[model samples]
Target: MKWHHVQDNWPAFFEAILDRWPDADEAELEEIDGDQRAFIAYVIELTGQEPEEARADIREWLSGELPSDVVMDPRHDNHSIALSKKYVPEGEDEYDDDSRFGDEE
Candidate 1:
């Protein structure tokens, strides 16, 4: 299908889903709407920028602004702490299992 056709028919998405499950709560509907808007806005934003500019801007923004720490829910067995320890170690690749590399070749 053409791009314009897909864009034009986008509004029908809400009706089709809602028609299937009309009893969905207000919060659920709002979430669906918010996701749709965010996706569409992302597509629009990225459509025109050059790849280099987009990548550099995104990298700079993420590196300079995003926090290194995250708040974890203490209810869980602190899975976040465990995952972070493995993925983002105090030293690089500390938790990585290098044994898998020998099998790949």
Candidate 2:
């Protein structure tokens, strides 16, 4: 989905995946978080799809028939780096980056 769509629906999407894989351990949960972020980045950078189209794509991908493996190699891809940078707020401490998402300090 688009960046905003993913940002808005991330909690639901994350919960759904967790429900599907209730046996996931701590490391698996961390991997899931990374995968979800990578999926958001992929949809924004590669597809350029609007919210509806991106949501449909996400639903299809989450259907379990295909792998949900999104390559998150931002270090090598300028487009990925640009997309990621768009979410980084200016004048924010790198360690406090969660504030961009409205997390409290």
Candidate 3:
């Protein structure tokens, strides 16, 4: 997906991806989701955070750079969860490369 799509759908998309793997980062995600981490990075960009901000946050928290309470707060504005259910319809094509979405290239 394009970065514009990620900007529009960041909240929901990120939430879904993170829910599947709360500790995921670009490299780890690249193995699991292929090119789709571009979308995840795009979501972080839309937040005005760096590509690795989320991953760094996870790492720092794990290393005690930040308090556990700060890290574990559910109130953190992960917009992905809220937007996820609305952007793509049930059974709709999400993968730009999906044969179901027609030939992408």
Question: Quick one: best lDDT, which candidate?
Answer: 2
Candidate 2, 8: how far from true, in Å?
21
Q: Write one digit per residue (lDDT tens) for candidate 3, span 36-80.
A: 455446446544567678556433433422222222335432443
lDDT for each residue of candidate 2 in 1-105, tens digit (9 for 90 to 100): 434443444444555444543443444444445455565455544457776676676676565422123323555354555556657789643444466667766
Model 2 collision count:
0
Pull out the clashing pairs in model 2.
none
TM-scores for all candidates: the values are 0.23, 0.27, 0.21
Model 1 TM-score is 0.23
Clashes of each: 0, 0, 4
lDDT of each: 0.42, 0.50, 0.45
Name the best candidate (by TM-score): 2
Q: Which ten residues in a row are the worst by lDDT in model 1?
A: 64-73
lDDT of 1: 0.42
Model 2 lDDT, residue 67, Cα: 18
Ranking by TM-score: 2, 1, 3
Candidate 1 stretches greater than 4 Å from native:
1-47, 67-69, 73-105
